[model samples]
Target: MNRKTLVLPAVVGLLAPVLAACGGSDSGSSGGDAIVVGTTDTFTQLKTRPAPLDPAYAYDVGTWNVLRQTVQTLMAYPKGDGAPQPDAAQSCGFTDSGNERYACTLRKDLKFSDGTPVTADDVKFSMERALTIKDPEGVFALLSTIDTIETKGDRQVIFHLKTADATFPFKLSTPVAGILNPKDYEKDKLREGFSIDASGPYTLKAEVKDKSMVKAVFTKNPNYKGLLDVKNDKVELESFPSADAMGEALSKGDIDVMARAMTPDQIDKLSAKTNGDINLVEMPGLEIRYLGFNTEADSVKNKAVRQAMAQVINRGQLVSEVYGTQAEPLYSMVAATVTGHSNAFLNKYGDPSVSKAKTRLTEAGITTPVKLTMHYTTDHYGAATKKEFEVLQKQLNASGLFDVSIKGYRWQEDDYKTKEQKGQFDVYGMGWFPDFPDADNYISPFLDKDNTLNTPYVSNKIRNQLLPQSRREADRLSAAKDLTEIQDIVAEDVPLLPLWQGKQYIAARDDITGSEWAINSSSTLQLWELGRGVKG
Candidate 1:
């Protein structure tokens, strides 16, 4: 799946007061009434394609947050440990020892929000359309392993893979594998506009948009048949321009919950609150931030130059200065929480040292003060990104071995399509929210020949040998040796620099139930779990 990027209009000022007046009371209704959710995430539109709520085109976490409520995947992760469980399917498992042939039997009488019956054919159509359309900004790459999709009558669906892949089930659980109604969505093109017709806990009642989505209203789908027992009857997801605005909206009771994009300082202040009106829910997050290199670029093409820069950079100081306690230093492409993670970068480079960086560059017969340009998005990640990049510039320039300059661009309009996707920057900062909570999800998307980053990272050993071997193991933990070696290779090559891993935070009213269980490990929000608590 594509990395999570936020794109909201500057209408927070206009939204807060109006929403506050119309907001519901803190008490629960017997039928479970509507609750408003606040976020800095908004609907993103590509220059060439339609707004990305369609299953075939949607990729990022923001789109998935809404899609997860409206579209049902065959398999899905439950509230507890991150494991794929049957959602639309009554049962699913691999039919072969090679982990190549997977099969699923659809639940009896599953219907879409529009009252159309869901069949194995719908599942096949959904997967086929995503691969066929192959939107450049979409998550088609995640489904590339499927060689063929076969439907056995109306109930059974089978997936034949090109190679052994234990992570296939986990991928199917993501929104990229969200099943679609063939009658509603065209097979060869992305469905235009914000309308949705799928079988999930909720259906899109209305969407307010001006250039970008300002609000989306969702209502419980009475025809929906799935694993989720949706708690609320209705929900409204409101978008804000900044984290401060999102927090302000939550503080003033304009929104019952603040889902994402809150600053560290805001979180700290909220945590220190002695009042019983608000609750801060913290969960283990799989989100990570890193700096990627364009191996074809003149400034950082040389492996030695990338290695030198890596040696001089300080991850501890970066997280401490910019994120405070909101994030921790990261060392591997695979997050520290994932099994088989290694501190390969730290083990190789040790702590940040200018002398070591200087020696590495001098030994390579390179000139002093290497000119480097770093690129970052202005609006996507959060407000702290600017300060983070500033700290990075100061760190690199302080070494006296490199001269760094930073540039910012709007994520959807320019940076993603024209700059980063085309590999125009020598060095660029990006964040990764894993498609699934697995080590392979973290590694393969960035290291493969045709990676998500659009950088020139063609590793013969990783792409051809190590990754294939790891996927063959049915027991995921058994692939640790290969995974560790891959991290070692990444540390030596330095195609990307690991920076910090983030924790998920959700601030909600004290009366809001299931606030702690709202988001799963993959960073997809489970809006079905959110509801108002009963009064004493």
Candidate 2:
């Protein structure tokens, strides 16, 4: 696939029990109580609180899970509407035939919480500053392509892109392109931290370290010129360390929501009692979890060997047994929701027979006993993940073709990517969450050689023409046509193998209404925007 199409800028944590459901609430009001959505993470910092929190630097889905209401973009998806609608900007679109020139005019009365003007210069500053920041991760690297930006006056700003970037406008619609106060970001030198200065309806009202975190109160910023689709009176986010803690808190009526991925026993216990205390809504997620074969791994380097390893496991059984039908078998690189998903690998190998594995290994003339370590972040997904890996080890070892070993690391601890990058494992389980709604978000990050996940992934063909060619295309949907082909090629080469397509599931208290999220959140818990039966 056009690997770049799937560029995931958000941290993209797996499933978090959200206060929201698949369809986000249009008029955000949960039943009687003050909407106090619960989350499982605490942030390291919020130094430059976003005026309209920008998603370019750090777009934690968990955080947005709470912060979305307080923050908005130039455009937004009002539930059931696939395309974006106006929010902050009075009107915004492309004026030039070539799609190189874009313009947005403010609603005139817009101001930040601090009562500063949300002018064209502020918008320019946000984009430029995000680019200048040291996000070596290149999450904001897309801004590098901008040719020039100028304010067409006080209320109107025009963007003349370097190329005909059709998606540039849509890019602006994302949180990354949200407007920010030049003063806050400027003083911080565009550095990321915890004291947020948001212009959204809510703000980070309070804070504590990791133990027990609380959010103050949310008040409408007078300068807020309506832009985002969500409308909520007030809300607060509460943080818990583990699911157990979240459940205990929920039972005590201390918190209002929990995102999915509970222990099978936890789901069973919660499911059995018909207290109407929780609601679980499942929707097709914009994420996929896969087994990445570090090309640098000698065992994985051999095409035949990689093919044999890929053919041994039954993805269907893994999904059914491991995820308990919570997830779907993902044979394609891009998730199903992504526009152009193709079963290229499945078409080539077909149903994964033991005979096929042996045949592939036999044909390869592989004499060396192939052995490799599989790695995964322990804290992120759930208990099933470990079981999934163990089952994998059993399946591969049973084939008599591989001496598989399993290793695990706590994601909360620092070894998350470091140990994996050190090549301590031949294969590791990883997931991709979309940065935006486009299919391009799926392919870009993992396949790009310089990206975090691609450390062991090196394919010149996919990297060069196929990838760069797709990226140059201004039409994202059309670009998916190219990306679909690339995903198939990458599958054939076995640098990374698709495993499962996840469905987003968040558990919330029944009375707590008006919480829903159909979008992909890369995983940060934000606590502002929620209201308990309160709306302005």
Candidate 3:
């Protein structure tokens, strides 16, 4: 459980509008060595771990980002861009009726690494199996908007949609939508298998449990043909136990690059020590830190109670002292880089005002000395979290109006997210990195009644139908306008409070290049494009 959202120092200016990118990576020069990448994702039990490295359960973005390189999809992204373009498919489109229809034509020369030809059945099986899984990590959830999956001839896949959603293709470009082999689970039961059954750039070599994970050399499929959004033929990943630990490793020249978070102290040290051969690259992150109030809790159920509590929150003090000055103030439910973000809450509430908060509480006929519990994840967000919430406790308690208790989880485990998503605690903090680069990513997860994020949120008009409708619109820019309206409603409702956004900090050895992050609203990193220079 964490309370504040992480905002970046650089993206306060770039969070608006859209930028079109060519859908795939341009070819880059190849090198002799495997590029070791570092990250702090050791805890989350990859639901799809060691399972053919398929996309059926690539629910977590970090997990999916890894799978994307190992498994090729029907289409890939444009160079330096985020939108999709055809690759394996000659072209795909909906039926003129616009309902009960979608079709795709497969590339002429395409085969899985196993030499099995890529066909329409593969696509159909990949999707149908997901829908059959009752709950498939989130693949089904993405395509749940779909009504039916059908195939025409040996090369065409038909998707019958439940609604005229324009974002389906964008959703398809996701790794969760990656195609898989039918024979792996051809028996109808999704039994686990560790063999390579993909048509990707690289194949899995080994998975080290909880400590490190490494991918073998990537090789172009001699007969392999599929869409790609990257330039490199083969890539490798070496995972570290934690970001802080990874930073130490990168500095020791143990790894080629660092592609994850860093301790605030490590970042400060890296910023000052240029001659040490480490490069510290900073970018706006899609993850935000925020405190969610369990609106269903009697003490917090009332709008006045929630509002009163929010007003006394001293965001500025917390960022400076606890975050090591690595944060900024946030006023929107969505982060700065996300589309449709607005400072509606700032406009309405101004700053932390104990007097005003107390007045509201009194006027509502409620007393202070309220008891509250806040949940946080100890491992995922780093050491700054405990202090972050402690700062929150100090602010709320000093108002002479509330009593606060804090709880913690060990990253994705502690099942803290489930509790927070289920709306179990009085108040909890979470750091959300977007699933994709749309503003809908912010509003959709938190506001969707089905998403379990409405935990502290009761079913409301805007969240129920309006947000979904916005997501259905094909035009993301237009959808952004609708999502902004939903943001205002959420901020006014106080279902969740906006806190701060995070910046991505990577501490890489100077020889590594192309670790540049996508300015995506989701802040996705294209690890496939990174390479190592000859050892200097």
User: Model 2: what TM-score?
Assistant: 0.82
- Best-matching candidate per TM-score: 1
Residue lDDT tens for model 1, 1-536: 01122211110111010011112234444255688999888675555546568877776778888888888989987763446789999999999999999999999999998888998989999999989988766378888889999999999999999999998998888777888889888889888878888898888965555556788888999987767878789889998988999888888988989977888888888767655577776655778999999998888888889999889889999999999887899988888878768899999999899999999888988898999888898777888899999999999999999999999887766735457777788898988888887789888888865567766877899999999999998777788899999999999999999999987777778667666567655567888778787421
Better of 2 and 3 by TM-score: 3
Badly placed stretches (over 4 Å) of model 1 are 1-32, 415-418
- TM-scores of the candidates are 0.93, 0.82, 0.84
What is the lDDT, from 0 to 100, of the residue 357 in candidate 1?
90
Per-prediction backbone clash count: 0, 60, 33
lDDT of residue 458 for candidate 1: 79
Global Cα lDDT for candidate 3: 0.63
**Candidates, ranked, TM-score:** 1, 3, 2
> What lDDT does model 2 reach?
0.61
What is model 2's C-alpha RMSD?
6.4
Total backbone clashes of candidate 2, pairs 3 or more residues apart or in separate chains: 60
